[model samples]
Target: MATARHARPKELENASLEEIMDRYVARYADRRADWAAFEDAKIEGYKRAQHRFIGAGGSGKHNDVSAIPAGNFTLSIMYVPPGQGNAAHTHEVEEVFFVLQGHLDVFVQDEDGRKISKRLGPWECISCPAGVIHGYDNNSLEPVYFQVMLGRGKPETMGYADDDLYKRRDEHLKAVS
Candidate 1:
């Protein structure tokens, strides 16, 4: 006896944004419908802490999530502990930062190595261009909550000069400690 062959369903073949969003929401709802699994995920998300200690430079903590490819952006949620800062660094791509809390002093170096600095407070945002040497210092007594979005570029491609070392090791140590 010959077996009957069944036809396969076609793919979405270009769904609209509304359709995609509706499907995504429905999928999340289904995943969250499982009480135990949802709760476990929430707990795990809260418990996974990541920190980078200061060596010759500075230290801070970060909580990063795998980024989506929708807008060619990488998003990170980071917390700079009070009195901690990053070593002078720069990136080869444009980046945007939104300060959700606390204050930060950003020092930037231009093409000729001339340094310029500015202070950022809560709700402040800055757009940093590519190839500019830059780094941040936490000037507040509390941890700063911030989100950073980077464009597609190897951050290491930007040139850096460790001019901030003197600021950290010499002038700021007594003040910070």
Candidate 2:
């Protein structure tokens, strides 16, 4: 949900209605496909492609000029293959996962390492609050497509719960660049 504290990009602050519509629109055909978007995406269980829409979500591709300049939030469409998902991660702002296709197993973990998961089918969604350890998996026999939204336009990248992965969090940027 958008808030009253939104910050409009400079280009949109005083643009004509036509220009605003043109620049603000994000089309599925124009999404940027980035596999290996996060540190865990380099691991077997976390292999998925991040299709950038608004900003780069939490993928750390902050300079992705092709994306619409975000205002207080970011959005991306994730393409998760069967048997793949992401490592548990926490962020400074809330993150929403809305399933668009296929079944996804979304989970949030306790400090003691226990995790609770629920299966989300098409049109289902979950909003993981800030600082919560959470992630999702495509445990079904097919691939899955879901939309992810972060509560900040240029927020810090995710904090992985796994020490090794956390240490190499910025490596994804190096690999992609």
Candidate 3:
């Protein structure tokens, strides 16, 4: 059921390696944001948060894209300072991350609900299956930047496990200690 589109616009077209690189360079030329914006959607939710994702580029600043719908897929650029990273969360869809710069220490839940941590370097990629509880922690001295792509449906739900993170604070302390 995975059919690729044939005639996408040159800008949005999924192209070969060289062509994609060309498009990226051209797109980056006139763009002025410290980081890149990939996609966004407007919706009426319980908390009313704008659904926007950015492409990997800067240290802390990001240019989020919200003008277009992700259409079953979401892409975002995640940047974490030396010691800062995202909290544990899970989505209804699978996600794939490509490391663009620096290194990232990713933490995810195992079958027995244990945390599995892995350090990935540039050009490496990681995948989080749907319904998996996972998050990333930046333990490197330098900032870590990566691009995240997730599958999305028309009605998508994003769930965070912040409470679970706190609940596992004892495990966290043990890891850091």
- Measured by TM-score, the strongest candidate is 2
Model 3 agreement with the true structure over 1-177: per-residue lDDT tens digits: 877667666656556768555434423334343221111111111111112343321111122332133345655556556765655567666777688889888778854668989999999988988778886766779877677776652323334565643343233123222
lDDT tens per residue, model 1, 1-177: 965386322433466668555543322112211111111112222111112111111111111111222233444445666665554556667766678888877777765778788889889988778766776767668777666666751122223354433333333222223
Residue 22 C-alpha lDDT in model 1:
54
Better of 2 and 3 by lDDT: 2
The weakest ten consecutive residues by lDDT in model 1 span 52-61
- For candidate 1, give the lDDT of residue 111: 59
Question: Which 10 successive residues of model 3 have the least lDDT summed?
Answer: 39-48
How well does candidate 2 match the true structure in TM-score terms? 0.90
Model 1 regions lying over 4 Å from their true place: 1-71, 111-113, 153-177
lDDT of 1 at 12: 35
- Pairs that collide in candidate 3 are 39-65, 40-66, 72-152
Q: Report lDDT per candidate.
A: 0.47, 0.90, 0.52
Q: What TM-score would candidate 1 get against the native?
A: 0.51
Tens digits of per-residue lDDT for model 2 on 49-86?
99888887887888877788888899999999999999
- Distance from true location, Cα of 114 in model 1, Å: 3.9
